[model samples]
Target: MEDHANSRHKKTVQPVAKARQEVYVLRDLKEYLGESLLIIFSVLLALVLTEFINKQHEKSQTKELLNNIKEELKKNKQAEQEQYVYQQGILKRIDSVLRDPGLQKKVLTDGTFHLDYLAPEGVSLHDLSRVAWQVAQSHDITPKLEFKLVEMLTDIYDQQARIDKIEDKEAAVFLNYESRKPENIRETLILMRDNYHGWAFDRAPALIKKYDAAIKEIDRDL
Candidate 1:
Protein backbone atom coordinates (compact mmCIF):
# COMPACT_ATOMS: atom_id res chain seq x y z
CA MET A 1 0.00 0.00 0.00
CA GLU A 2 2.92 2.43 0.82
CA ASP A 3 4.49 1.65 -2.59
CA HIS A 4 1.20 2.36 -4.37
CA ALA A 5 0.83 5.66 -2.47
CA ASN A 6 4.41 6.60 -3.46
CA SER A 7 3.66 5.88 -7.19
CA ARG A 8 0.50 8.05 -7.05
CA HIS A 9 2.46 10.95 -5.46
CA LYS A 10 5.13 10.63 -8.22
CA LYS A 11 2.43 10.84 -10.90
CA THR A 12 0.95 14.05 -9.40
CA VAL A 13 4.44 15.62 -9.01
CA GLN A 14 5.32 14.82 -12.70
CA PRO A 15 2.15 16.51 -14.01
CA VAL A 16 2.73 19.61 -11.84
CA ALA A 17 6.34 19.98 -13.14
CA LYS A 18 5.18 19.61 -16.74
CA ALA A 19 2.57 22.29 -16.16
CA ARG A 20 5.24 24.68 -14.76
CA GLN A 21 7.45 24.08 -17.85
CA GLU A 22 4.57 24.93 -20.18
CA VAL A 23 3.90 28.18 -18.32
CA TYR A 24 7.60 29.20 -18.67
CA VAL A 25 7.56 28.49 -22.45
CA LEU A 26 4.44 30.66 -22.93
CA ARG A 27 5.99 33.52 -20.93
CA ASP A 28 9.19 33.44 -23.05
CA LEU A 29 7.13 33.49 -26.29
CA LYS A 30 5.17 36.57 -25.07
CA GLU A 31 8.42 38.40 -24.21
CA TYR A 32 9.95 37.65 -27.64
CA LEU A 33 6.81 38.86 -29.48
CA GLY A 34 6.69 42.08 -27.45
CA GLU A 35 10.36 42.84 -28.17
CA SER A 36 9.87 42.23 -31.94
CA LEU A 37 6.88 44.57 -32.01
CA LEU A 38 8.86 47.27 -30.24
CA ILE A 39 11.69 46.99 -32.82
CA ILE A 40 9.28 47.31 -35.77
CA PHE A 41 7.65 50.39 -34.23
CA SER A 42 11.03 52.06 -33.72
CA VAL A 43 12.09 51.44 -37.33
CA LEU A 44 8.82 52.85 -38.70
CA LEU A 45 9.04 55.90 -36.50
CA ALA A 46 12.61 56.55 -37.67
CA LEU A 47 11.63 56.28 -41.34
CA VAL A 48 8.71 58.67 -40.89
CA LEU A 49 10.87 61.19 -39.02
CA THR A 50 13.50 61.12 -41.76
CA GLU A 51 10.91 61.72 -44.47
CA PHE A 52 9.40 64.69 -42.62
CA ILE A 53 12.80 66.34 -42.12
CA ASN A 54 13.65 65.97 -45.79
CA LYS A 55 10.40 67.62 -46.83
CA GLN A 56 10.89 70.61 -44.54
CA HIS A 57 14.45 71.09 -45.76
CA GLU A 58 13.30 71.12 -49.37
CA LYS A 59 10.60 73.65 -48.55
CA SER A 60 13.13 76.07 -47.05
CA GLN A 61 15.39 75.69 -50.06
CA THR A 62 12.52 76.41 -52.43
CA LYS A 63 11.62 79.63 -50.66
CA GLU A 64 15.22 80.85 -50.70
CA LEU A 65 15.60 80.14 -54.40
CA LEU A 66 12.33 81.85 -55.19
CA ASN A 67 13.44 84.98 -53.39
CA ASN A 68 16.65 85.10 -55.38
CA ILE A 69 14.73 84.62 -58.59
CA LYS A 70 12.30 87.39 -57.68
CA GLU A 71 15.08 89.87 -57.10
CA GLU A 72 16.68 88.98 -60.40
CA LEU A 73 13.35 89.41 -62.16
CA LYS A 74 12.79 92.80 -60.59
CA LYS A 75 16.16 94.03 -61.77
CA ASN A 76 15.51 92.70 -65.25
CA LYS A 77 12.14 94.42 -65.33
CA GLN A 78 13.69 97.79 -64.54
CA ALA A 79 16.32 97.38 -67.22
CA GLU A 80 13.74 96.26 -69.77
CA GLN A 81 11.53 99.21 -69.01
CA GLU A 82 14.41 101.59 -69.56
CA GLN A 83 15.25 99.92 -72.83
CA TYR A 84 11.61 100.07 -73.88
CA VAL A 85 11.44 103.81 -73.24
CA TYR A 86 14.63 104.53 -75.16
CA GLN A 87 13.63 102.31 -78.07
CA GLN A 88 10.17 103.85 -78.23
CA GLY A 89 11.73 107.27 -78.42
CA ILE A 90 14.08 106.04 -81.13
CA LEU A 91 11.13 104.55 -83.05
CA LYS A 92 9.34 107.89 -82.94
CA ARG A 93 12.35 109.61 -84.45
CA ILE A 94 12.62 107.01 -87.17
CA ASP A 95 8.90 107.31 -87.95
CA SER A 96 9.15 111.08 -88.21
CA VAL A 97 11.62 110.73 -91.08
CA LEU A 98 9.77 107.84 -92.77
CA ARG A 99 6.26 109.32 -92.60
CA ASP A 100 6.80 112.98 -93.51
CA PRO A 101 6.62 113.86 -97.21
CA GLY A 102 9.20 116.66 -96.69
CA LEU A 103 11.73 114.22 -95.21
CA GLN A 104 11.06 111.76 -98.02
CA LYS A 105 11.71 114.51 -100.56
CA LYS A 106 14.94 115.41 -98.78
CA VAL A 107 16.12 111.80 -98.91
CA LEU A 108 15.27 111.37 -102.60
CA THR A 109 16.42 114.76 -103.98
CA ASP A 110 19.65 115.41 -102.05
CA GLY A 111 22.65 113.49 -103.48
CA THR A 112 24.84 113.74 -100.35
CA PHE A 113 22.16 113.79 -97.64
CA HIS A 114 23.05 112.02 -94.39
CA LEU A 115 20.55 110.21 -92.11
CA ASP A 116 21.72 110.13 -88.50
CA TYR A 117 18.33 109.34 -87.02
CA LEU A 118 18.39 105.59 -87.62
CA ALA A 119 17.57 103.63 -84.49
CA PRO A 120 20.51 101.61 -83.16
CA GLU A 121 19.87 98.06 -82.04
CA GLY A 122 21.98 98.73 -78.98
CA VAL A 123 19.19 100.93 -77.60
CA SER A 124 16.74 98.03 -77.68
CA LEU A 125 18.91 95.37 -76.06
CA HIS A 126 17.13 93.90 -73.01
CA ASP A 127 18.68 92.80 -69.77
CA LEU A 128 18.55 89.03 -69.33
CA SER A 129 20.21 87.27 -66.40
CA ARG A 130 19.40 83.66 -65.57
CA VAL A 131 21.97 82.79 -62.95
CA ALA A 132 19.45 82.14 -60.20
CA TRP A 133 17.23 80.15 -62.52
CA GLN A 134 20.12 78.14 -63.87
CA VAL A 135 21.19 77.27 -60.35
CA ALA A 136 17.71 76.06 -59.43
CA GLN A 137 17.47 73.93 -62.56
CA SER A 138 20.95 72.47 -62.29
CA HIS A 139 20.46 71.44 -58.68
CA ASP A 140 16.99 69.93 -59.25
CA ILE A 141 15.29 72.29 -56.83
CA THR A 142 12.83 73.32 -59.51
CA PRO A 143 10.82 70.11 -59.15
CA LYS A 144 10.25 70.84 -55.47
CA LEU A 145 8.45 74.09 -56.29
CA GLU A 146 4.73 74.28 -56.96
CA PHE A 147 3.77 73.01 -60.39
CA LYS A 148 2.17 76.28 -61.44
CA LEU A 149 5.19 78.30 -60.38
CA VAL A 150 7.52 75.99 -62.24
CA GLU A 151 5.41 76.26 -65.37
CA MET A 152 5.41 80.04 -65.21
CA LEU A 153 9.17 80.19 -64.79
CA THR A 154 9.73 77.87 -67.74
CA ASP A 155 7.48 79.95 -69.99
CA ILE A 156 9.01 83.24 -68.98
CA TYR A 157 12.60 82.14 -69.47
CA ASP A 158 11.86 80.35 -72.72
CA GLN A 159 10.16 83.40 -74.22
CA GLN A 160 12.98 85.66 -73.11
CA ALA A 161 15.53 83.40 -74.77
CA ARG A 162 13.53 83.30 -78.00
CA ILE A 163 13.21 87.06 -78.08
CA ASP A 164 16.94 87.43 -77.49
CA LYS A 165 17.71 85.21 -80.46
CA ILE A 166 15.29 87.01 -82.74
CA GLU A 167 16.57 90.44 -81.76
CA ASP A 168 20.17 89.32 -82.32
CA LYS A 169 19.26 88.16 -85.81
CA GLU A 170 17.55 91.46 -86.58
CA ALA A 171 20.55 93.41 -85.34
CA ALA A 172 22.98 91.32 -87.37
CA VAL A 173 21.01 91.91 -90.57
CA PHE A 174 20.73 95.68 -90.03
CA LEU A 175 24.36 96.16 -88.96
CA ASN A 176 25.78 94.43 -92.06
CA TYR A 177 24.84 97.43 -94.20
CA GLU A 178 28.16 99.20 -95.14
CA SER A 179 26.91 101.73 -97.66
CA ARG A 180 25.17 105.10 -97.27
CA LYS A 181 23.89 105.06 -100.89
CA PRO A 182 20.25 106.14 -101.14
CA GLU A 183 19.08 102.68 -102.22
CA ASN A 184 20.95 100.98 -99.36
CA ILE A 185 19.54 103.58 -97.01
CA ARG A 186 16.01 102.93 -98.19
CA GLU A 187 16.44 99.15 -97.95
CA THR A 188 17.86 99.31 -94.42
CA LEU A 189 15.08 101.67 -93.33
CA ILE A 190 12.48 99.24 -94.66
CA LEU A 191 14.18 96.40 -92.77
CA MET A 192 14.15 98.48 -89.61
CA ARG A 193 10.50 99.22 -90.20
CA ASP A 194 9.65 95.54 -90.39
CA ASN A 195 11.71 94.69 -87.32
CA TYR A 196 10.22 97.49 -85.26
CA HIS A 197 6.73 96.49 -86.32
CA GLY A 198 7.18 93.09 -84.68
CA TRP A 199 8.98 94.61 -81.71
CA ALA A 200 6.39 97.27 -80.92
CA PHE A 201 3.34 95.13 -81.53
CA ASP A 202 4.31 91.77 -80.12
CA ARG A 203 7.66 91.36 -78.36
CA ALA A 204 7.50 94.39 -76.10
CA PRO A 205 4.01 93.63 -74.89
CA ALA A 206 4.84 89.99 -74.29
CA LEU A 207 7.92 90.81 -72.22
CA ILE A 208 6.04 93.25 -69.98
CA LYS A 209 3.24 90.76 -69.50
CA LYS A 210 5.59 87.92 -68.62
CA TYR A 211 7.51 89.96 -66.06
CA ASP A 212 4.32 91.17 -64.43
CA ALA A 213 2.82 87.70 -64.32
CA ALA A 214 5.92 86.18 -62.78
CA ILE A 215 6.11 88.91 -60.18
CA LYS A 216 2.49 88.38 -59.26
CA GLU A 217 2.94 84.65 -58.92
CA ILE A 218 5.99 85.05 -56.70
CA ASP A 219 4.17 87.55 -54.53
CA ARG A 220 1.42 85.03 -53.84
CA ASP A 221 3.97 82.53 -52.59
CA LEU A 222 5.92 85.03 -50.53
Candidate 2:
Protein backbone atom coordinates (compact mmCIF):
# COMPACT_ATOMS: atom_id res chain seq x y z
CA MET A 1 0.00 0.00 0.00
CA GLU A 2 2.76 2.47 0.86
CA ASP A 3 4.55 1.78 -2.48
CA HIS A 4 1.33 2.52 -4.45
CA ALA A 5 0.77 5.83 -2.50
CA ASN A 6 4.33 6.93 -3.31
CA SER A 7 3.81 6.22 -7.04
CA ARG A 8 0.56 8.35 -7.13
CA HIS A 9 2.29 11.30 -5.37
CA LYS A 10 5.16 11.25 -7.88
CA LYS A 11 2.73 11.34 -10.84
CA THR A 12 0.80 14.37 -9.44
CA VAL A 13 4.01 16.38 -8.72
CA GLN A 14 5.39 15.64 -12.26
CA PRO A 15 2.23 17.07 -13.96
CA VAL A 16 2.37 20.29 -11.82
CA ALA A 17 6.04 20.87 -12.71
CA LYS A 18 5.28 20.39 -16.45
CA ALA A 19 2.44 22.99 -16.32
CA ARG A 20 4.73 25.60 -14.68
CA GLN A 21 7.38 25.00 -17.37
CA GLU A 22 4.80 25.61 -20.19
CA VAL A 23 3.59 28.88 -18.53
CA TYR A 24 7.19 30.19 -18.33
CA VAL A 25 7.76 29.45 -22.02
CA LEU A 26 4.59 31.40 -22.98
CA ARG A 27 5.65 34.43 -20.92
CA ASP A 28 9.08 34.50 -22.58
CA LEU A 29 7.50 34.28 -26.07
CA LYS A 30 5.22 37.27 -25.32
CA GLU A 31 8.14 39.41 -24.14
CA TYR A 32 10.17 38.58 -27.26
CA LEU A 33 7.24 39.49 -29.52
CA GLY A 34 6.78 42.82 -27.75
CA GLU A 35 10.43 43.71 -28.14
CA SER A 36 10.32 42.88 -31.88
CA LEU A 37 7.23 45.10 -32.37
CA LEU A 38 8.89 48.05 -30.56
CA ILE A 39 12.00 47.78 -32.72
CA ILE A 40 9.90 47.81 -35.94
CA PHE A 41 7.96 50.84 -34.77
CA SER A 42 11.12 52.78 -33.94
CA VAL A 43 12.64 52.06 -37.38
CA LEU A 44 9.48 53.14 -39.19
CA LEU A 45 9.23 56.36 -37.19
CA ALA A 46 12.85 57.25 -37.99
CA LEU A 47 12.31 56.70 -41.69
CA VAL A 48 9.26 58.96 -41.74
CA LEU A 49 11.04 61.69 -39.82
CA THR A 50 13.97 61.59 -42.22
CA GLU A 51 11.68 61.91 -45.22
CA PHE A 52 9.93 64.93 -43.75
CA ILE A 53 13.21 66.67 -43.08
CA ASN A 54 14.42 66.07 -46.61
CA LYS A 55 11.24 67.53 -48.07
CA GLN A 56 11.53 70.69 -45.99
CA HIS A 57 15.14 71.15 -47.05
CA GLU A 58 14.20 70.77 -50.69
CA LYS A 59 11.44 73.34 -50.37
CA SER A 60 13.79 75.92 -48.91
CA GLN A 61 16.34 75.37 -51.64
CA THR A 62 13.75 75.70 -54.38
CA LYS A 63 12.39 78.95 -52.97
CA GLU A 64 15.85 80.47 -52.81
CA LEU A 65 16.53 79.52 -56.40
CA LEU A 66 13.30 81.14 -57.57
CA ASN A 67 14.06 84.38 -55.80
CA ASN A 68 17.51 84.55 -57.35
CA ILE A 69 16.08 83.84 -60.77
CA LYS A 70 13.47 86.55 -60.38
CA GLU A 71 16.08 89.11 -59.46
CA GLU A 72 18.13 88.18 -62.48
CA LEU A 73 15.09 88.52 -64.74
CA LYS A 74 14.45 92.03 -63.45
CA LYS A 75 18.02 93.03 -64.21
CA ASN A 76 17.81 91.60 -67.70
CA LYS A 77 14.58 93.47 -68.34
CA GLN A 78 16.16 96.75 -67.36
CA ALA A 79 19.10 96.05 -69.61
CA GLU A 80 16.83 95.26 -72.51
CA GLN A 81 14.97 98.54 -72.10
CA GLU A 82 18.18 100.54 -72.05
CA GLN A 83 19.49 98.65 -75.06
CA TYR A 84 16.27 99.27 -76.97
CA VAL A 85 16.54 103.01 -76.44
CA TYR A 86 20.17 103.03 -77.51
CA GLN A 87 19.37 101.05 -80.65
CA GLN A 88 16.57 103.46 -81.48
CA GLY A 89 19.03 106.29 -81.39
CA ILE A 90 21.31 104.35 -83.70
CA LEU A 91 18.39 103.77 -86.10
CA LYS A 92 17.59 107.46 -86.22
CA ARG A 93 21.18 108.19 -87.10
CA ILE A 94 21.08 105.57 -89.82
CA ASP A 95 17.86 107.05 -91.17
CA SER A 96 19.43 110.47 -91.35
CA VAL A 97 22.25 109.06 -93.45
CA LEU A 98 19.80 107.16 -95.64
CA ARG A 99 17.69 110.28 -96.30
CA ASP A 100 20.69 112.42 -97.20
CA PRO A 101 22.43 111.24 -100.35
CA GLY A 102 25.08 113.89 -99.70
CA LEU A 103 26.16 112.05 -96.55
CA GLN A 104 27.20 109.06 -98.63
CA LYS A 105 29.10 111.33 -101.00
CA LYS A 106 30.73 113.07 -98.04
CA VAL A 107 31.86 109.71 -96.59
CA LEU A 108 33.41 108.71 -99.89
CA THR A 109 35.24 112.04 -100.30
CA ASP A 110 36.43 112.15 -96.70
CA GLY A 111 37.60 108.53 -96.78
CA THR A 112 36.64 108.24 -93.10
CA PHE A 113 33.64 106.93 -91.13
CA HIS A 114 32.36 106.82 -87.57
CA LEU A 115 31.64 103.20 -86.55
CA ASP A 116 29.92 104.41 -83.35
CA TYR A 117 26.85 105.32 -85.42
CA LEU A 118 26.40 101.58 -86.10
CA ALA A 119 27.02 99.96 -82.67
CA PRO A 120 26.89 101.98 -79.49
CA GLU A 121 29.16 101.80 -76.43
CA GLY A 122 26.92 100.26 -73.75
CA VAL A 123 25.31 97.54 -75.84
CA SER A 124 26.88 94.17 -75.04
CA LEU A 125 27.26 91.26 -77.46
CA HIS A 126 26.44 88.79 -74.69
CA ASP A 127 24.15 88.41 -71.70
CA LEU A 128 26.19 89.59 -68.73
CA SER A 129 23.96 88.34 -65.85
CA ARG A 130 23.59 84.72 -66.82
CA VAL A 131 25.14 83.38 -63.63
CA ALA A 132 21.77 82.68 -62.05
CA TRP A 133 20.64 80.79 -65.10
CA GLN A 134 23.84 78.77 -65.16
CA VAL A 135 23.39 77.86 -61.51
CA ALA A 136 19.78 76.78 -61.95
CA GLN A 137 20.69 74.62 -64.92
CA SER A 138 23.62 73.03 -63.14
CA HIS A 139 21.40 72.22 -60.17
CA ASP A 140 18.67 70.75 -62.42
CA ILE A 141 15.96 72.99 -60.95
CA THR A 142 13.87 73.78 -64.02
CA PRO A 143 11.30 71.21 -63.12
CA LYS A 144 10.84 72.86 -59.76
CA LEU A 145 10.10 76.29 -61.28
CA GLU A 146 6.68 77.42 -62.47
CA PHE A 147 5.93 76.34 -66.03
CA LYS A 148 5.21 79.81 -67.35
CA LEU A 149 8.30 81.20 -65.70
CA VAL A 150 10.44 78.54 -67.25
CA GLU A 151 8.97 79.18 -70.68
CA MET A 152 9.56 82.90 -70.49
CA LEU A 153 13.09 82.48 -69.18
CA THR A 154 13.93 80.11 -72.00
CA ASP A 155 12.47 82.44 -74.64
CA ILE A 156 14.28 85.49 -73.27
CA TYR A 157 17.64 83.74 -73.15
CA ASP A 158 17.19 82.43 -76.67
CA GLN A 159 16.39 85.91 -77.94
CA GLN A 160 19.47 87.23 -76.15
CA ALA A 161 21.60 84.66 -77.92
CA ARG A 162 20.17 85.67 -81.27
CA ILE A 163 20.81 89.32 -80.54
CA ASP A 164 24.38 88.57 -79.55
CA LYS A 165 25.02 86.73 -82.79
CA ILE A 166 23.57 89.57 -84.82
CA GLU A 167 25.66 92.10 -82.92
CA ASP A 168 28.83 90.09 -83.61
CA LYS A 169 28.00 89.96 -87.30
CA GLU A 170 27.30 93.67 -87.37
CA ALA A 171 30.60 94.38 -85.63
CA ALA A 172 32.49 92.31 -88.17
CA VAL A 173 30.76 94.10 -91.03
CA PHE A 174 31.60 97.51 -89.58
CA LEU A 175 35.24 96.52 -89.10
CA ASN A 176 35.42 95.39 -92.71
CA TYR A 177 33.80 98.61 -93.85
CA GLU A 178 36.35 100.66 -91.92
CA SER A 179 39.24 98.80 -93.61
CA ARG A 180 37.85 99.31 -97.12
CA LYS A 181 39.24 101.79 -99.71
CA PRO A 182 37.62 105.16 -100.62
CA GLU A 183 36.05 103.72 -103.79
CA ASN A 184 34.19 101.10 -101.70
CA ILE A 185 33.07 103.55 -99.00
CA ARG A 186 29.62 104.32 -100.38
CA GLU A 187 28.67 100.66 -100.80
CA THR A 188 29.88 99.80 -97.32
CA LEU A 189 27.96 102.72 -95.78
CA ILE A 190 24.80 101.62 -97.49
CA LEU A 191 25.21 98.06 -96.22
CA MET A 192 25.90 99.24 -92.69
CA ARG A 193 22.96 101.61 -92.71
CA ASP A 194 20.57 98.90 -93.86
CA ASN A 195 21.84 96.40 -91.26
CA TYR A 196 21.48 98.90 -88.44
CA HIS A 197 17.99 99.89 -89.49
CA GLY A 198 16.82 96.27 -89.67
CA TRP A 199 18.21 95.32 -86.30
CA ALA A 200 17.14 98.47 -84.46
CA PHE A 201 13.60 98.62 -85.78
CA ASP A 202 12.76 94.92 -85.91
CA ARG A 203 14.94 92.64 -83.82
CA ALA A 204 15.76 94.95 -80.92
CA PRO A 205 12.19 96.09 -80.36
CA ALA A 206 10.90 92.51 -80.45
CA LEU A 207 13.42 91.41 -77.88
CA ILE A 208 12.55 94.35 -75.69
CA LYS A 209 8.90 93.40 -75.76
CA LYS A 210 9.77 89.87 -74.68
CA TYR A 211 11.84 91.21 -71.83
CA ASP A 212 8.96 93.35 -70.69
CA ALA A 213 6.61 90.42 -70.67
CA ALA A 214 9.04 88.30 -68.72
CA ILE A 215 9.57 90.99 -66.17
CA LYS A 216 5.87 91.43 -65.65
CA GLU A 217 5.37 87.73 -65.16
CA ILE A 218 8.20 87.46 -62.68
CA ASP A 219 6.89 90.41 -60.72
CA ARG A 220 3.45 88.90 -60.54
CA ASP A 221 4.74 85.52 -59.45
CA LEU A 222 7.08 86.89 -56.86
Q: Give the best candidate by TM-score.
A: 2
**Model 1 alpha-carbon drift over 4 Å, by segment:** 1-27, 97-125, 177-181, 199-201
218: Cα error in model 1, Å? 1.9
Q: What is the lDDT of candidate 2?
A: 0.67
TM-score of 2: 0.70
lDDT of 1 by residue, 17-40 (tens): 444343444467889999999999
TM-score of each: 0.70, 0.70
Quantify all predictions' global Cα lDDT against the true fold. Answer: 0.69, 0.67
Best by lDDT: 1
Candidate 1 structure, TM-score to reference:
0.70
Q: Give the true-structure RMSD of model 1.
A: 10.5
